[model samples]
Target: MLPSKTSVTDRSWRAGTAPGALPLLGHVPALWRRPLEFLASLPAHGDLVEVRLGPARAYLAAHPELVRHVLLNPRLFDKGGVFDKARQLLGNSLSVSRGEEHRFQRRLIQPAFHPTRIAAYTTAVAADTRTVTDAWRAGETRDIGDAMHSLLMRVAARTLFSTGLDEATVEEARQCLRTVSHGIYKRTVAPLGIMEKLPTPANRAYDHANARLRQIVADMIAVRRRSDEDHGDLLSTLLRAEHPETGQKLDDGQLLDQVVTFLVAGSETTASTLAFVFHLMGRLPEVEKRVHAEVDAALGGRTPVHEDLPALPYIRNVITETLRLYPPSWMAMRVAAEDVELGGRKVPAGTMILYSPYALHHNPDLFPDPEIFDADRWAGERAAQVPRGALLPFGAGSHKCIGDVLALTETALIVATVAARWRLRPEPGSALRPEPKATLEPGPLPMVLERR
Candidate 1:
C-alpha cells in the first residue's frame, strides 16, 4: 500500500516499495518488459521509491534532488550496478573505476578530447556523414537504426584509429558490438548469474563477440606499435599519453580497456541519439522543415564540420530534446559506500542506487507538457529556467562523460548534413518500440528518405 499523497510531500515520508513482486523475480519482470514506463511511473509514489532487482533491493531516486546527491557525492555512492557488470567487458577503464584510480584514468584519457584534437576529429565526422548520404537514393526507405549504427561505427573507427585497420576488420568489429550489447542487460538483472553460464545462443554470441573484438583490437595495437609515426587520432593520443603524477604510460591491458570503452561508447550512444532525432524529425513535419531551413542557410549543401556548430543552434536543441525524451543512457546506478542521507531519508550502506534521466526529463512538474517535443524551449528565456541537474543526458559531477562535447557536435553535424540533402519521413506502417538494451534503441525505425 502507498502512503497518502500529502504524506509523500512531508519531510519524514519514507519511500514506498513498488507493488507486484513475484517470489523469486521481484520487479525483474517489470524492468525486463517495460523499463522506461516502469522508471517513469515511480515519481508518483515518492521521491525515493524502493524496488527489487532479482533478489536484491535497490532504491530508485525519483527526484532530481535525490539524484544530485548520488551523482555529486561519488565517494559516498561510487560507480556500481550496471557499471560493475561492465567490468567483464571493460577492465579498469574510467567507466567502472572509483576513488583515486578513477581520477588517474580520467587524467590519461582527457587529453584526446582537447579543443584542437576534437576539431581534427570533426573532419572525420563530416567525411563519414557524406559517405552515408552519398549511398542513399531519393525515395529509398532506410532502416535508420542500423544505418546510424553503421555510420557511427565508421566515424568512431576513423576518429579512434584513423584507418589503422582494414575496412573488413572495422565492419566485423561493428557487428560484434551488436551481439555483445544484446547480452549485457540480461546478465545485469539475473541474480547469482548461473543462467548466463549455460550454452544459450545469446550467451554464445556474447562470448564469441567479446573474444573476437579483443583479438581485433590487440592486433591493431601490435601493428600500431610496430610503426613510429603519430596518426593524430585517439589511439595515438592514448598510446603516447603519460600519467601526470606518475609519468607512466598505460599498459596494453589498460589501453585495450580504454579503446574498447571508447569504441563501443563513442559509437553506440551518439548513434542511438541521432536515430531518435531523425525519427522525431520524421514525425513532426514542422520541426523537420525548420531544421532543413536552418541547414540550408547554414551550410548550403556543404558538409557540416565541428566549427559550424554555433551556426546551427536549432539542430543542437533538437538533439537536446531528443536526449531528454529518450536518453540512451537511461539508467545510471551507484552503490552506497557507507550510510548516508538523501532527500531527508536515511540510506543504508551497500544499497544499489538507480536514477533515470529519462524519468526526470519527463516530469510534468519540472517541464510542462513533457510529452511534446519542443526545441524552442531551449532557445530563449525558457532554456534558462530549466532547473540545474534536471537535464542529465550526459550525467553530472566529476564522473560526467568525457566525450560530451564531441557527442553533441557529432549529433548536430549529422542532423545538419542529413537535412541539407533529405528529409526523413517515418514509415507509417511500422510501430516503433523502445528496446531497452545497452542503450534505449528505437527498434526497427524504417524511414522514407524524401529529397528536399
Candidate 2:
C-alpha cells in the first residue's frame, strides 16, 4: 500500500527499494534498460526512495515538494556527482561552482543574460535560423537531430563570441563537444577511477576532444585580447565584467572555463529541444497546423524579428509543452552538506541526492493526461495553475539557467522561422526513441521537409 501523506510525514528515516533491485547492482540494470520509465515508476515505492548505484547508496526525491526543498537550500544540497565530472570539461565555471564562488560567478555572468542584452541577440538568432532552413531542399530526408545541433552551434558561436570563430573552427568545436558529451553519462554513473584511466577507445576520444576544446577556447581568447576591441557579445561582456564585491575580473584560465561552460550548456540543451519540437510537429498534425497558421499570421512570410515574439503566443506554448514532455536536463545530482530532514525523514550529511525532471513532469496528479501533447494547456489560466517546481526545464532556484531568456528567445524565433517555411513529416519506418545522455535527446529523428 502507498504510504499516506500524514503517515509519511510522521515516520522516521527509512529506505524503500524499487521492484527489480539485485545484489550489488541494485536498480542499475532497470535504470539502464529504460531510465525515464524506471524513474517515473519510482514514486510508487516512496517519496524518498533508496537508489543504489553499484553499492553507492543515493536518495531519489520522487515528490515535487521534496525536490523544491532540496533545490532552494543549496547550502544543504550542493552540486556534486555529474557536475564534478563536468568540471573535467567546464572547469570551475558557474554551472559547477558552489557557495561563494558560485555567487560571485553568477554576479559576473548575470548581465550577459539581461532582458535588453538578450533582445539584442534576436537578429543574430534569426539570421542563423535562416542560414540553416534556407539550405534545406524540399522532399529531402534530413536528420533533424543533426541539423538542429549544427544550426544551434552556429547560433551559439555567433551570439556568444560574435564573429570570433570561422566556419572551420565552429565545425571543429562542434565535433569536439559531441565527442566529449558521448561519455559523460557513463562517467557520471559509474565513476570508476581506475576504469576511466584505462586506455580504452572511449577514453582516448574523450582526451582528444578535451584537448581540442581547450585549444579552441584559448585561441578565441587570445585573438580577442590582441584585438582589444569590444564587440558587444557575451565574451566581451565577460572580459569587461568585474566582481561586485571584490572588483576582481576573470583571468585568462577562468575566461576559458566560462567559455567552455557556455558552449556545452547552451548549445546542447537548445538543440535537443528544437529537435524534439520538430519531431513532435511531424507526429501531431493538428499541432503542426496551428503552428503554421500562427507563424504565417505573425510573420507574414517575412523573416522573424525580436518584436514578433509577443504576437506568436501559440509558438511559445508549443515550446513549453515540448519542454514538459522532453526536458533536456533530464536528471540532476547533488550531495548533502549536512544532516537534514527531507520529506520528514532524516538525511545524513554526505548523502547523494538524485532528482529527475522527467519523472516530476510526468506525474499524473500534477498534470492530467500527462502523456498527451497539449500546447493549449499552457494558454490562459491553465498555465497559472501549474505547481511550483513541477516544470523545471531550465531548473529552479539560484542555479536556474542564467541564459534562459536567451534560450527562449532563440527557440521562439527558430520555431516561427521554420514553421513559416516548411512542414516536417516523419520518414517511413522511423521510430522516435529517447536517448538519455547527459541531456535527454531524441535519437535518430529523420524527417522529410515539405516547403509550405
Best by the lDDT measure: 2
Clash count, candidate 2: 0
Candidate 1 lDDT by residue in tens digits, 330-378? 8878899888776566778888898999889888877789899999879
Stretches of candidate 1 off by over 4 Å are 1-26, 53-56
Deviation of model 2 at 75, angstroms? 1.0
The residue pairs in collision within model 1 are none
Score candidate 2 by TM-score against the native.
Answer: 0.94
lDDT scores of the candidates, listed in order: 0.83, 0.85
What alpha-carbon RMSD in Å does predicted model 1 have with respect to the real structure? 4.2
- The stretch of ten residues in a row with the least summed lDDT in candidate 1 is 1-10
**Local distance difference test, candidate 2:** 0.85
